[model samples]
Target: MTVTIESVITCPSCSHQAAEIMPTDACAYFYECTSCHLLLKPLAGDCCVFCSYGSAKCPPSQEQKGCCA
Candidate 1:
């Protein structure tokens, strides 16, 4: 199955719009805020981009596999 998800992040420091894609096979650990140049990481207990921003949770999380598993 082709698993693709999109999410948007607003930099807390600069209010920059970051449109990103969540990978199905891997979890992204860090994201650089384009506008503020701040490095973004998953919030406490969050697994991936979808869990943080997307309308739906990450695929693994949805399956109860947890993040990056």
Candidate 2:
């Protein structure tokens, strides 16, 4: 499968959305919402913020390689 690099992350606190590039080699544990400035972390059972809040899962997960986290 083709892994998508881009993802749209939505902040639960302010409902702000931002497009971001996910890391290919590692998981992004933290993210800062550009609009609300709320720090984001992966929810339980997720490996990265993208998995918990993004439109797409991170590259490693997309490729079925589990999570680098």
TM-score of each: 0.69, 0.95
User: 1-69 in candidate 1: lDDT tens per residue?
Assistant: 544466666665677776776676788776788777787776778976457645566667766777775
Please report the candidate that would top TM-score against the real structure: 2
Q: List the residue pairs that clash in candidate 2.
A: none
lDDT by residue for model 2 (1-69), tens: 778999999999999999998989988999999998999999999999999999999999988889974
Off by over 4 Å in 2: none
TM-score of predicted model 2?
0.95
Q: Give the per-residue Cα lDDT of candidate 1 at 20.
A: 73
In each prediction, how many residue pairs overlap at the backbone (N, C-alpha, C within less than 3 A)? 0, 0
Instruction: List per-prediction Cα lDDT, in the order shown.
Output: 0.68, 0.94
lDDT of 1 at 19: 73
